[model samples]
Target: MAPTKPLLLDGSTGEGGGQLVRLAVALSAVTGQPIRIVNIRANRTRSRPVGKRGSVHVTGGGLKNQHVAAIKCLADATRAETTGLSAGSATLTFTPTLPPSRLPRRPLKIVPESDASSAMLIFQAVLPFLLFADVEEGQGVEVEIHGGTNTSWSLNYEYMDLVLLPTLEARFGVRVERELRRRGWSQGPAASGCVWVKVYPVRKGESITPLQLPIPLGKERDTRGPRDHFEVESVDVALVVPLRLLEPLQTALARDIAGVFPSAPEIDFRVVEDSGHQARIYVLLVAKSPTGLRWGRDVLHSPPKGSSANPTSMADALSRLAVKQLVEEVDSRGAVDVYLQDQLVCFQALAAGRSSFARHGDGRGGGVDVDGVAGAPGPTPDIEGDGLRREKTHEPFGHGSMHTKTARWVAAQLLPGVQFFNKGDVVEGAGIRFA
Candidate 1:
């Protein structure tokens, strides 16, 4: 039975970003609970001019174009009623009309209001409901999303297709087939694109198998130390840049990979498409363990603002930056990178039994640092203009990123039976089933 009173969530909690809204609404739809979020995106504050004398004043909060789209799309999928459904709203309520078991397994489509809105973010927001939806044997749901595939602050389409989906299937028995119909880029003039996702949802009576920690075998290389590092047997690189820079990027990538990994794992150029504009340059490197564990690190290059900027130098720098970040991830000896570390939390809460992953290094709190930035892989939301700036927390607890910590917090709030221990290294799932 649905709760008579809506579960209240403070938007300023934890990471206090779009993720809270995404996870809350998805959980509400799947668990048949109603949620009311106040102070939405409160920590995300924007600065504007107070007068004409160049003095700036801070104004904060509210949903972006992509966030509002995610809530509405998920509501449509589950027949949920919503309040404050417009963009820039600071408070919202979501109440599903139908229970999880009654959600029909049918094709759904999502089109974001702006070309710059991330399709992958929309995918993350609605995926849980689809996964827990009612469906017959041999039945699946198809979701088509339209928006930017490579956005500034969100996960790109290539990462989801090559890394995220595969790891989910390999580790937790959740299968989602992703196909890219067209390429989208937010850097160069905000291009629109499309993606088709077919989900093999967990049926009414069946539940997702619990996640088990990966056993640490000996390292793939001849390292004279502990026998705890999981072997990275191969690496796949996806590079999207101008056609003129292809050979240079490939050369730099090979040199960097050899210098860092030293294990001589098989390197495959999975994607080598031309991004059509120099500003749209992006690269993703995914390391695969023989145990089916995958970790990914990527960057969408934002070239210096100058007509005199050299394309060759920028491309080389982009390659070097991506390589350096990915090497950091591989050296940490964690099962997943900082981003995926948190992304998996929701699934852990939804599954039955216990789920855990090997903590990175001594399991102390740490995060990925690209160039000199602390928290995010891309441009940390611009706080000066209409953008918001947030800080990263490194308090000692399982070494998970702020996003990871926030995700675990949200799951625990929505699913009472789910409990997290050792920071977020271990979790007891809610064992959610449609039937």
Candidate 2:
């Protein structure tokens, strides 16, 4: 049974960004719970000089355009009621109708008030609700998000299309088909674009499959010493830049990939699209494991305004940086990128059973078992009894990025039944069923 009083959350805690609000609302809708969040996006308030000569600094905070758009879209889909659904409201109360109503058959559309708002951020906010929505069999929910597709400090469209969507489908059985109508940019000149996504919700009476990311050298037969590293089987490079810089970008990318993974087979490099503006240049490099896991890194390079920099030099620099970051990621041997690790916390908490993955991509396979409670440590899986009881002294869940910790904290607040262990490498889920 649903609780009578609304759950209260402090928006200033943890990551203290718009994502906290997004996850809170989506979980509230899915679980048919009411929530009240105070001090929303409190830490996100920023002051920057905007006027001529950078003389005056204007400060802005609270819900942004994309945040409101996501909230409204989820509210409409779930027939949920909201209080303080405005541009800069500090508090929000969201109450979803109990026993979730059936979502409409037609597609839903969302347009942010600002062209610079990230469409992917909006998509992330509503994905959980849509994945568990009450939809008919052989049917999918369509969402058309019109805003900045490649905005700064957010996941871009190509990353979603190439990395996130595929990983979700393969690991969790959640499928989403994407269609990009046009490119949007926040760099150089700001322009709005559209991305249509058709999400295939989990079937009635079924729950999302628990994610089980493979450990690098846990195999019994391949005991080739203890130093086992993550293997990169293939590479996919996607570029979007001006027509003139395409050749140099390609050349630089190829050289970097060769230097990084010369032994790896199957490298596919291509220009997915051409950015019309000289200021807009983006590169994404994804490394795939034989087990189908992917780790990706990207950079949306925006040269200094009015700087007379060489375009070819700029392209080469961007390629080198992007590839260098990717090499670091691969070297880390993480099951997913740093960003994706945190993003999966919500799913792990809501899924049907235990979901376990690697804690660190350090290539050395080991995990420190964690207690269900936060900040407390538990026993090591290999150790025994009272001797190992003292092992729980350290902060067991302190491995992931702040974003990861924030997402994990949000999941814990919304779904109390879920338990985290192994520094968030293992999740005992709520087993939430859509039907």
Candidate 3:
């Protein structure tokens, strides 16, 4: 029998990057649904300087090497049928292998051509399948990928290792690990990198758990807005820098981070070999909360032009970026960081139960997790949202408001009955299942 026609998506939706495509493919694999996306990378347009710096010309919209590479990797993962799977193609179709439970037995490998391509983006694209992969007892899926580890617009491996995965372990019960075999930078597409990941499948009959937002110690509802009380329990910062700036940048960053934490959280700093062709600085900030989970943000050092830049500026730039981001995230009052918020949207929706978390905002207040005692905010599969719907508002759930908006937009489009609210930052999953 012919497969049902897939859901058609507007590639211009949300941020118009590969996110919508990734979400669509992941869900399609799980739900056994086919999806077709038109106008790939429609949110972006091709632009080049016509002459002077101030002058530029728009040459219409198109897909980039990274976008093409991402979709291809995902297509290979599910052994899916696809059309328009080449660079610059504007329309794409994906038909997953039937039953939505089949996965590769051998280690899956995907490599990028340029250094600027994000391995993290590719990893993020395929992670959902790994989480729910079907494997024999004592067996897990292995993925080996090559791309930039520390790049703009994607989470670094450290964030995944120290922060994001840890949160998954604590909150969602996912068992995963990462091994960095080589280092890659995002200065441009020519730079190269490598990373390996092993995701242990959940036991038979077990399902992914939902995310739950904590209420306050004595409060009925959370009112913390964007900034809330998330105590910093630990701090792990890793730096891979050139030999010339190693000691200086390391020492300077450590001192700067000290002032950010008044409670004297456990802080550790390490200096490692620099990766890639050019000398660069990489910083990973993994902040943990005893009452909640880990929140991570990594800052890539902007290379100094000529001989004018010094060690102080390098350390200061990343230090400022790291400290300021952590503080703002703590204040945001959301359950996860803005970046992590994007990562979790798909998982929360795919899981089998109810999940809730504090929404992001700039105001102040408090709340606590009431799950264990109350057995979560509501029942499994469907959640009731009283806040403003995504279509009706512009408020973001967390960081990169547009990104959170994008995730919600993708979910709403692909998963019917899945709704996200503005004020509450609460989401109702589509109750997606593989059986």
**What is the C-alpha local distance difference test score of each model?**
0.74, 0.74, 0.65
Q: Per-residue lDDT tens digits of candidate 3, residues 1-435?
A: 147888888777767777777777777766657889897777766666565666554533555566567667766766779998776778888887644256657898887665677887888777776766778877888888888887776777677777778777766677877888876776533467798988887665566776443443534343633322367757777777666666666767667667887756888773355643334667777776645555677777656456466766766766778788877776665566767767777766666655555444444321323223111222123333333344433322332456667776666656665655343355555655443
Better of 1 and 2 by TM-score: 2
- Cα RMSD to native, each candidate? 8.9, 5.0, 5.5
How does model 1 score by TM-score? 0.85
| Span of ten consecutive residues with least summed lDDT in model 3 | 370-379
Q: State which candidate, 1 or 3, has the greater TM-score.
A: 1
In the range 1-435, model 1's lDDT, one tens digit per residue, is 555579899888878888888998888888878899988888787555666767564544588888888888877766787898888788999988786666655688888788888989999988887887667766778999998899878989989988888778866888898899987888877689899998888867777765443434653463764332345678899988877778888888887787777667789999998888867788999987655566799988767556565656666687789988887777776667778877887888888865655344553322322211111122223232122222222221344677777787788778887755544565667888866
Q: In order, how many clashes per candidate?
A: 0, 4, 21
- Of the two candidates 2 and 3, the one with more favorable TM-score, higher being better, is 2
For every model shown, what is its TM-score relative to the native structure? 0.85, 0.86, 0.82
List candidate 3 segments past 4 Å from native.
47-61, 211-229, 276-279, 361-400, 417-424
> Looking at candidate 3, what is the lDDT of residue 84?
84
Q: In angstroms, give how far residue 206 of model 3 lies from its true place.
A: 3.2
In angstroms, the error of model 2 at 133 is 2.0
